[model samples]
Target: MIEDLQKYYGYLFEEALLKEIADVAIAKDIKANDIIIDIGSYITSIPLLLSGAIKILREDKEGDDLVLYYIEKGDTCAMTLSCCMGETKSKIKAVAETDVRLLMIPKQKMSEWLSKYKSWQEFILHSYHNRLQEFIDAVDTIAFLNMDQRLLKYLKDKALVNHNDIITVTHQQIANDLHTSRVVISRLLKALEKRHKIELHRNQIKLLEL
Candidate 1:
């Protein structure tokens, strides 16, 4: 666990802080598609990603989820930090995009370490900045891009995060992430297939010229 912590976070934290984290943080392994955080749940810890990817989502009024972005290894979720600091229930959902390894630090340590460690404070602030930019990108994708373009970006992102060109996912799952109907997703996916951007299989989509 210490080696994993140092591997992912050494550059961002001091040796003493890293040691403390290894001692106190609970190391966890989450399988793909598992819920890391759920809407309306009280967040109790902050996760420092060790490996794999997690997708952050926002729920719409009709209870559909819209993918915001994916966080890979060596990243911490800003939404989790916010929930910890504000002492509020989570408004976002974090789902494991791949089998994941992470360290969960007690939420109370967030404030304590913020004042105690310079690196911790800087890391938190930087995480927030990065997350805000991702949110802006998500908004831009929804507002400026066409549905097909959005779907293309989504597929590329999934491939990138999963570290595989061949993504194992269904059209209906894509629809759920994009907040659209499965029929619409299936139609657009076939169009992409015709354009030679992707190859559709039984339940998977292989990225091509994308």
Candidate 2:
């Protein structure tokens, strides 16, 4: 685990700081679809992803979830940082999108590192900036883009994040992520197929073009 940390975060921090992180961070492995954080839950630690991916989601009052963005290897969840710093509950949810390994730093250690290590401060700030940009992009997509365009973009993103052109997902799952009806998603997917943008099969989509 220390070696993995060094591989991902070595250049970002000094040797001493890296050592401190290795000593204090708790390493854990999680399976796909595991809920890492839930809405309104207190965050006691911040995770540094070592491998695989996590999908950050926002849940509505009606218990619907919308995909916000993905945090993959070498990334951290900025929402976790916000909750830890403010000692507040998390409004967003994080779920493992694939089998994942991560190192968790306790809230106290996270606070201490921010003050003690310049690199740590920079890392946190960078994560916040990236997440904010992603949020802005999502807002623009929802407000300006049509559903077909949005579905295409979503598929492209999922393909890129998973590093596979063939996506294993159901139309209903895509509908849930896009906050639309399964029938609508199915129709749009068929339209995409007619345009030669993708190939659809039972519960899977093979992206043929962007």
Best by lDDT: 1
Q: Write the per-residue lDDT of candidate 2 for residues 102-207, one digit (tens) a residue.
A: 9999999887888999999999999999999999988899899999999999999998888899999999999999999999999999999999999999988999
* Whole-model lDDT values for every prediction: 0.94, 0.92
- TM-score (all chains, Cα) for each model: 0.97, 0.98
Error of model 1, residue 191, in angstroms: 1.0
Per-candidate clashes come to 0, 0
How large an RMSD does model 2 have? Answer: 0.9
lDDT tens digits, residues 86-170, model 1? 9999999999999999999999999999999999999999999999999999999999999999999999999999888999998
TM-score, structure 2 vs. true = 0.98
- Off by more than 4 A, model 1: none
